[model samples]
Target: MELVTHSPGDGVYPPTGDYAHAIEVRGAERLVFLAGTMGLDPSGVPGATLDDQLVLIWSNIRVILASAGMTVDNIVRLTSYLRDASYAGANAKARVEALGGRVVPTTAIVAQTLDSEWLIEIEVTAAS
Candidate 1:
Protein backbone atom coordinates (compact mmCIF):
# COMPACT_ATOMS: atom_id res chain seq x y z
CA MET A 1 0.00 0.00 0.00
CA GLU A 2 2.23 2.79 -1.22
CA LEU A 3 0.98 6.01 -2.85
CA VAL A 4 2.95 8.89 -4.24
CA THR A 5 1.73 12.39 -3.39
CA HIS A 6 2.89 15.52 -5.14
CA SER A 7 3.06 18.97 -3.60
CA PRO A 8 4.98 21.11 -6.03
CA GLY A 9 7.21 23.91 -4.76
CA ASP A 10 6.35 26.03 -7.78
CA GLY A 11 3.69 28.73 -8.04
CA VAL A 12 0.84 26.38 -7.21
CA TYR A 13 0.11 26.69 -3.49
CA PRO A 14 -0.02 23.69 -1.24
CA PRO A 15 -3.38 22.30 -0.14
CA THR A 16 -4.39 23.37 3.33
CA GLY A 17 -6.77 20.58 4.26
CA ASP A 18 -6.76 16.78 4.41
CA TYR A 19 -5.83 16.47 0.74
CA ALA A 20 -2.89 16.61 -1.59
CA HIS A 21 -2.36 18.51 -4.79
CA ALA A 22 -2.43 15.18 -6.56
CA ILE A 23 -1.63 11.48 -6.08
CA GLU A 24 -0.20 8.73 -8.20
CA VAL A 25 -0.40 5.01 -7.60
CA ARG A 26 2.16 2.75 -9.24
CA GLY A 27 1.68 -0.93 -10.03
CA ALA A 28 -1.80 -0.96 -8.59
CA GLU A 29 -3.26 -4.38 -9.18
CA ARG A 30 -6.86 -3.43 -8.40
CA LEU A 31 -8.97 -0.33 -8.20
CA VAL A 32 -12.43 0.31 -6.80
CA PHE A 33 -14.87 3.11 -7.42
CA LEU A 34 -17.59 3.34 -4.84
CA ALA A 35 -21.05 4.71 -5.41
CA GLY A 36 -22.10 8.10 -4.14
CA THR A 37 -22.69 7.23 -0.48
CA MET A 38 -25.13 8.95 1.79
CA GLY A 39 -24.91 9.33 5.56
CA LEU A 40 -27.46 6.75 6.53
CA ASP A 41 -26.68 4.26 9.29
CA PRO A 42 -27.24 0.50 9.18
CA SER A 43 -30.74 1.07 10.49
CA GLY A 44 -31.36 3.47 7.61
CA VAL A 45 -31.75 6.40 9.95
CA PRO A 46 -29.93 9.62 9.20
CA GLY A 47 -27.76 11.25 11.86
CA ALA A 48 -29.29 14.00 13.97
CA THR A 49 -26.50 16.50 13.43
CA LEU A 50 -24.05 17.48 10.75
CA ASP A 51 -20.98 16.20 12.60
CA ASP A 52 -22.65 12.91 13.43
CA GLN A 53 -23.68 12.52 9.83
CA LEU A 54 -20.13 13.25 8.69
CA VAL A 55 -18.71 10.61 11.03
CA LEU A 56 -21.25 8.05 9.98
CA ILE A 57 -20.53 8.87 6.36
CA TRP A 58 -16.88 7.96 6.80
CA SER A 59 -17.88 4.85 8.68
CA ASN A 60 -19.92 3.89 5.67
CA ILE A 61 -16.91 4.39 3.42
CA ARG A 62 -14.87 2.17 5.72
CA VAL A 63 -17.40 -0.60 5.36
CA ILE A 64 -17.40 -0.34 1.61
CA LEU A 65 -13.60 -0.45 1.54
CA ALA A 66 -13.44 -3.39 3.93
CA SER A 67 -15.75 -5.39 1.69
CA ALA A 68 -13.14 -4.99 -1.07
CA GLY A 69 -10.26 -6.02 1.24
CA MET A 70 -8.99 -2.46 1.36
CA THR A 71 -8.61 0.34 3.88
CA VAL A 72 -8.50 4.09 3.98
CA ASP A 73 -4.87 3.97 2.96
CA ASN A 74 -5.95 2.44 -0.33
CA ILE A 75 -8.08 5.47 -1.17
CA VAL A 76 -6.44 7.81 -3.65
CA ARG A 77 -9.20 10.29 -4.29
CA LEU A 78 -12.70 11.31 -3.23
CA THR A 79 -15.43 13.63 -4.47
CA SER A 80 -17.86 15.12 -2.04
CA TYR A 81 -21.27 16.69 -2.57
CA LEU A 82 -22.35 19.08 0.11
CA ARG A 83 -25.86 20.40 0.44
CA ASP A 84 -24.54 23.54 2.00
CA ALA A 85 -21.23 25.18 1.30
CA SER A 86 -21.22 26.66 4.79
CA TYR A 87 -20.40 23.26 6.25
CA ALA A 88 -16.97 23.33 4.67
CA GLY A 89 -15.14 23.92 7.94
CA ALA A 90 -16.87 21.15 9.84
CA ASN A 91 -16.58 18.94 6.78
CA ALA A 92 -12.83 19.45 6.47
CA LYS A 93 -12.37 18.74 10.17
CA ALA A 94 -14.36 15.56 9.82
CA ARG A 95 -12.40 14.56 6.74
CA VAL A 96 -9.09 15.01 8.54
CA GLU A 97 -10.33 12.83 11.36
CA ALA A 98 -11.73 10.18 9.02
CA LEU A 99 -8.49 9.79 7.05
CA GLY A 100 -6.31 10.26 10.09
CA GLY A 101 -4.77 13.24 8.34
CA ARG A 102 -3.74 11.24 5.30
CA VAL A 103 -3.42 13.38 2.18
CA VAL A 104 -6.03 12.22 -0.30
CA PRO A 105 -6.91 14.25 -3.35
CA THR A 106 -10.49 15.51 -2.97
CA THR A 107 -12.98 17.74 -4.73
CA ALA A 108 -16.05 19.18 -3.09
CA ILE A 109 -19.04 20.55 -4.90
CA VAL A 110 -22.10 22.21 -3.45
CA ALA A 111 -25.16 20.57 -4.83
CA GLN A 112 -28.64 22.01 -4.75
CA THR A 113 -29.86 18.79 -3.18
CA LEU A 114 -29.06 15.13 -2.98
CA ASP A 115 -31.15 12.07 -3.76
CA SER A 116 -32.82 12.33 -0.41
CA GLU A 117 -32.59 14.59 2.59
CA TRP A 118 -28.92 13.90 3.04
CA LEU A 119 -26.76 16.80 4.05
CA ILE A 120 -23.69 15.25 2.47
CA GLU A 121 -22.76 12.57 -0.01
CA ILE A 122 -19.33 11.19 -0.89
CA GLU A 123 -17.77 8.96 -3.53
CA VAL A 124 -14.35 7.35 -3.28
CA THR A 125 -11.79 5.84 -5.65
CA ALA A 126 -9.31 3.36 -4.19
CA ALA A 127 -6.39 1.37 -5.57
CA SER A 128 -4.51 -1.65 -4.35
Candidate 2:
Protein backbone atom coordinates (compact mmCIF):
# COMPACT_ATOMS: atom_id res chain seq x y z
CA MET A 1 0.00 0.00 0.00
CA GLU A 2 1.01 3.58 -0.64
CA LEU A 3 0.65 5.93 2.30
CA VAL A 4 0.33 9.62 1.46
CA THR A 5 0.59 12.11 4.26
CA HIS A 6 -1.17 15.43 3.78
CA SER A 7 0.48 18.30 5.58
CA PRO A 8 -0.33 21.78 4.36
CA GLY A 9 2.85 23.76 4.12
CA ASP A 10 1.01 27.05 3.70
CA GLY A 11 -2.21 28.70 4.89
CA VAL A 12 -3.07 26.09 7.52
CA TYR A 13 -1.05 25.67 10.66
CA PRO A 14 1.24 22.67 10.68
CA PRO A 15 0.65 19.67 12.88
CA THR A 16 2.57 19.52 16.12
CA GLY A 17 5.14 16.80 16.81
CA ASP A 18 5.39 13.51 14.93
CA TYR A 19 2.09 13.30 13.10
CA ALA A 20 0.54 14.20 9.80
CA HIS A 21 -2.52 16.34 9.34
CA ALA A 22 -4.05 13.42 7.53
CA ILE A 23 -3.04 10.15 5.91
CA GLU A 24 -4.25 8.66 2.67
CA VAL A 25 -3.87 4.94 2.34
CA ARG A 26 -3.99 3.64 -1.19
CA GLY A 27 -4.17 0.13 -2.55
CA ALA A 28 -4.65 -1.35 0.85
CA GLU A 29 -5.93 -4.92 0.67
CA ARG A 30 -6.31 -5.42 4.41
CA LEU A 31 -7.22 -3.27 7.37
CA VAL A 32 -6.62 -4.24 10.95
CA PHE A 33 -8.33 -2.41 13.80
CA LEU A 34 -7.04 -3.27 17.22
CA ALA A 35 -9.08 -2.82 20.37
CA GLY A 36 -7.88 -0.58 23.15
CA THR A 37 -4.85 -2.33 24.65
CA MET A 38 -3.56 -1.58 28.09
CA GLY A 39 0.03 -1.63 29.29
CA LEU A 40 -0.19 -5.12 30.69
CA ASP A 41 2.68 -7.56 30.78
CA PRO A 42 2.51 -11.24 29.87
CA SER A 43 1.20 -11.85 33.38
CA GLY A 44 -1.41 -9.10 32.90
CA VAL A 45 0.17 -6.66 35.27
CA PRO A 46 0.05 -2.92 34.74
CA GLY A 47 3.27 -0.96 34.71
CA ALA A 48 3.93 1.33 37.63
CA THR A 49 5.30 4.22 35.60
CA LEU A 50 4.30 5.93 32.36
CA ASP A 51 7.55 5.05 30.63
CA ASP A 52 7.33 1.44 31.67
CA GLN A 53 3.73 1.22 30.55
CA LEU A 54 4.56 2.88 27.22
CA VAL A 55 7.27 0.29 26.60
CA LEU A 56 4.97 -2.62 27.36
CA ILE A 57 2.15 -1.23 25.24
CA TRP A 58 4.38 -0.83 22.21
CA SER A 59 5.79 -4.30 22.70
CA ASN A 60 2.29 -5.71 22.76
CA ILE A 61 1.38 -3.74 19.66
CA ARG A 62 4.37 -5.16 17.84
CA VAL A 63 3.35 -8.68 18.75
CA ILE A 64 -0.16 -8.06 17.52
CA LEU A 65 1.10 -6.60 14.25
CA ALA A 66 3.46 -9.49 13.71
CA SER A 67 0.59 -11.90 14.10
CA ALA A 68 -0.92 -10.34 10.98
CA GLY A 69 2.35 -10.24 9.02
CA MET A 70 2.57 -6.47 9.47
CA THR A 71 4.88 -4.06 11.21
CA VAL A 72 4.81 -0.59 12.71
CA ASP A 73 5.07 0.77 9.18
CA ASN A 74 1.57 -0.47 8.54
CA ILE A 75 0.12 1.73 11.24
CA VAL A 76 -2.10 4.38 9.71
CA ARG A 77 -3.71 5.87 12.78
CA LEU A 78 -3.39 5.72 16.57
CA THR A 79 -5.35 6.86 19.60
CA SER A 80 -3.83 7.11 23.05
CA TYR A 81 -5.78 7.28 26.28
CA LEU A 82 -3.76 8.80 29.07
CA ARG A 83 -4.61 9.11 32.70
CA ASP A 84 -3.24 12.64 32.67
CA ALA A 85 -2.29 15.14 30.00
CA SER A 86 1.21 15.34 31.43
CA TYR A 87 1.97 12.00 29.85
CA ALA A 88 1.57 13.43 26.36
CA GLY A 89 5.22 14.17 25.75
CA ALA A 90 6.39 10.75 26.84
CA ASN A 91 3.66 9.13 24.81
CA ALA A 92 4.60 11.06 21.67
CA LYS A 93 8.24 10.21 22.14
CA ALA A 94 7.43 6.54 22.51
CA ARG A 95 5.31 6.59 19.37
CA VAL A 96 8.10 8.20 17.39
CA GLU A 97 10.53 5.62 18.62
CA ALA A 98 8.18 2.70 18.01
CA LEU A 99 7.35 3.75 14.43
CA GLY A 100 10.89 4.89 13.71
CA GLY A 101 9.73 8.43 12.92
CA ARG A 102 7.11 7.34 10.41
CA VAL A 103 4.41 9.94 10.96
CA VAL A 104 0.74 9.03 10.97
CA PRO A 105 -2.52 10.51 12.16
CA THR A 106 -2.57 10.35 15.95
CA THR A 107 -4.73 11.60 18.79
CA ALA A 108 -4.23 11.63 22.55
CA ILE A 109 -6.94 11.96 25.15
CA VAL A 110 -6.83 12.20 28.90
CA ALA A 111 -9.43 9.92 30.43
CA GLN A 112 -10.11 7.72 33.43
CA THR A 113 -9.43 4.07 32.71
CA LEU A 114 -11.33 1.03 33.89
CA ASP A 115 -8.36 0.09 36.04
CA SER A 116 -6.76 2.85 38.05
CA GLU A 117 -3.36 1.22 37.60
CA TRP A 118 -3.57 1.64 33.85
CA LEU A 119 -1.86 4.93 33.07
CA ILE A 120 -2.34 4.48 29.39
CA GLU A 121 -4.26 2.51 26.78
CA ILE A 122 -3.66 2.60 23.04
CA GLU A 123 -5.64 1.52 20.03
CA VAL A 124 -4.39 1.54 16.46
CA THR A 125 -5.51 1.08 12.89
CA ALA A 126 -3.14 -0.59 10.48
CA ALA A 127 -3.46 -1.27 6.78
CA SER A 128 -1.43 -3.26 4.31
Candidate 3:
Protein backbone atom coordinates (compact mmCIF):
# COMPACT_ATOMS: atom_id res chain seq x y z
CA MET A 1 0.00 0.00 0.00
CA GLU A 2 1.06 3.53 -0.67
CA LEU A 3 -0.03 6.68 1.15
CA VAL A 4 0.13 10.21 -0.15
CA THR A 5 -0.62 13.33 1.80
CA HIS A 6 -1.88 16.49 0.07
CA SER A 7 -1.23 19.95 1.35
CA PRO A 8 -1.75 22.49 -1.38
CA GLY A 9 0.30 25.57 -0.72
CA ASP A 10 -1.39 28.11 -2.96
CA GLY A 11 -5.12 27.59 -2.81
CA VAL A 12 -5.35 26.83 0.90
CA TYR A 13 -3.77 27.88 4.13
CA PRO A 14 -1.05 25.65 5.45
CA PRO A 15 -1.89 23.09 8.09
CA THR A 16 -1.57 24.53 11.56
CA GLY A 17 -0.45 21.27 13.14
CA ASP A 18 1.31 18.08 12.22
CA TYR A 19 -1.42 16.93 9.89
CA ALA A 20 -2.36 17.08 6.25
CA HIS A 21 -5.48 18.37 4.58
CA ALA A 22 -6.05 15.11 2.81
CA ILE A 23 -4.61 11.64 2.28
CA GLU A 24 -4.71 9.34 -0.68
CA VAL A 25 -4.25 5.61 -0.33
CA ARG A 26 -3.32 3.45 -3.28
CA GLY A 27 -3.24 -0.32 -3.71
CA ALA A 28 -4.70 -0.91 -0.29
CA GLU A 29 -6.19 -4.34 0.37
CA ARG A 30 -7.47 -3.81 3.89
CA LEU A 31 -9.29 -1.01 5.61
CA VAL A 32 -9.91 -0.73 9.33
CA PHE A 33 -12.31 1.76 10.83
CA LEU A 34 -12.04 2.01 14.58
CA ALA A 35 -14.80 3.17 16.86
CA GLY A 36 -14.56 6.34 18.82
CA THR A 37 -12.13 5.38 21.54
CA MET A 38 -11.66 6.90 24.95
CA GLY A 39 -8.83 6.66 27.43
CA LEU A 40 -10.49 4.01 29.55
CA ASP A 41 -8.49 1.17 30.99
CA PRO A 42 -9.22 -2.56 30.88
CA SER A 43 -11.47 -2.19 33.89
CA GLY A 44 -13.21 0.88 32.32
CA VAL A 45 -11.42 3.55 34.29
CA PRO A 46 -10.53 6.86 32.75
CA GLY A 47 -7.19 8.51 33.28
CA ALA A 48 -7.10 11.35 35.80
CA THR A 49 -5.39 13.91 33.60
CA LEU A 50 -5.13 14.86 29.95
CA ASP A 51 -1.53 13.71 29.66
CA ASP A 52 -2.30 10.38 31.28
CA GLN A 53 -5.37 9.96 29.10
CA LEU A 54 -3.39 10.74 25.97
CA VAL A 55 -0.91 8.00 26.77
CA LEU A 56 -3.60 5.43 27.40
CA ILE A 57 -5.50 6.40 24.28
CA TRP A 58 -2.45 5.94 22.06
CA SER A 59 -1.63 2.63 23.69
CA ASN A 60 -5.18 1.43 23.19
CA ILE A 61 -5.10 2.47 19.53
CA ARG A 62 -1.84 0.62 19.05
CA VAL A 63 -3.33 -2.60 20.39
CA ILE A 64 -6.42 -2.22 18.27
CA LEU A 65 -4.41 -1.60 15.12
CA ALA A 66 -2.15 -4.55 15.87
CA SER A 67 -5.19 -6.79 16.10
CA ALA A 68 -6.00 -5.78 12.53
CA GLY A 69 -2.43 -6.36 11.29
CA MET A 70 -1.70 -2.66 11.00
CA THR A 71 0.37 -0.03 12.78
CA VAL A 72 0.38 3.69 13.37
CA ASP A 73 2.16 4.11 10.07
CA ASN A 74 -0.92 2.73 8.35
CA ILE A 75 -3.19 5.38 9.74
CA VAL A 76 -4.55 7.66 7.06
CA ARG A 77 -7.21 9.61 8.84
CA LEU A 78 -8.15 10.57 12.38
CA THR A 79 -10.96 12.52 14.02
CA SER A 80 -10.62 13.71 17.56
CA TYR A 81 -13.40 14.94 19.86
CA LEU A 82 -12.30 17.17 22.64
CA ARG A 83 -14.46 18.20 25.56
CA ASP A 84 -12.96 21.69 25.38
CA ALA A 85 -11.21 23.71 22.74
CA SER A 86 -8.22 24.19 24.96
CA TYR A 87 -7.41 20.51 24.66
CA ALA A 88 -6.47 20.94 21.01
CA GLY A 89 -2.81 21.67 21.65
CA ALA A 90 -2.31 18.73 23.95
CA ASN A 91 -4.22 16.51 21.60
CA ALA A 92 -2.09 17.53 18.64
CA LYS A 93 1.06 16.98 20.66
CA ALA A 94 0.01 13.49 21.62
CA ARG A 95 -0.96 12.68 18.04
CA VAL A 96 2.42 13.79 16.69
CA GLU A 97 4.19 11.74 19.30
CA ALA A 98 2.04 8.68 18.72
CA LEU A 99 2.47 8.81 14.96
CA GLY A 100 6.13 9.77 15.24
CA GLY A 101 5.55 13.03 13.35
CA ARG A 102 4.00 11.31 10.38
CA VAL A 103 1.42 13.67 8.96
CA VAL A 104 -2.06 12.37 8.20
CA PRO A 105 -5.48 13.87 7.63
CA THR A 106 -6.79 14.95 11.02
CA THR A 107 -9.73 16.86 12.40
CA ALA A 108 -10.45 17.94 15.95
CA ILE A 109 -13.75 19.22 17.23
CA VAL A 110 -14.95 20.55 20.54
CA ALA A 111 -17.83 18.42 21.71
CA GLN A 112 -19.22 16.69 24.72
CA THR A 113 -18.42 13.06 25.23
CA LEU A 114 -20.73 10.26 26.28
CA ASP A 115 -19.01 10.07 29.62
CA SER A 116 -18.23 13.02 31.81
CA GLU A 117 -14.81 11.65 32.63
CA TRP A 118 -13.79 11.39 29.03
CA LEU A 119 -11.85 14.49 28.19
CA ILE A 120 -11.16 13.37 24.65
CA GLU A 121 -12.19 10.73 22.18
CA ILE A 122 -10.45 9.70 18.97
CA GLU A 123 -11.44 7.57 16.01
CA VAL A 124 -9.01 6.52 13.32
CA THR A 125 -8.96 4.87 9.90
CA ALA A 126 -6.08 2.67 8.87
CA ALA A 127 -5.44 1.10 5.48
CA SER A 128 -2.91 -1.52 4.52
Clash counts for all predictions: 0, 0, 0
Model 1 C-alpha lDDT per residue in residues 36-64, reported as the tens digit of each score: 88788999888878888898899999999
Question: Could you give the candidate ranking by lDDT, starting with the highest?
Answer: 2, 3, 1
The digit string of per-residue lDDT tens for model 3 on 24-106 reads: 99999999999998998888899999988999999999999999989999999999999999999999999999999999999
**Pairwise TM-score winner, candidates 1 and 2:** 2
C-alpha local distance difference test of each model: 0.87, 0.94, 0.93
Q: Decide which is better by TM-score, 2 or 3.
A: 3
**TM-scores of the candidates in the order shown:** 0.92, 0.96, 0.97
Q: Where does model 3 exceed 4 Å of error? A: none
Looking at model 2, residue 104 earns an lDDT score of: 95
Top model number, lDDT: 2
Give per-residue CA lDDT, model 2, range 36-112, as digits (tens): 98899999999889999999999999999999999899999999999999999999999999999989999999999
Output the lDDT of residue 77, model 1.
Answer: 91
Ranking 1 against 2 by lDDT, winner: 2
**Predicted structure 2, TM vs. truth:** 0.96
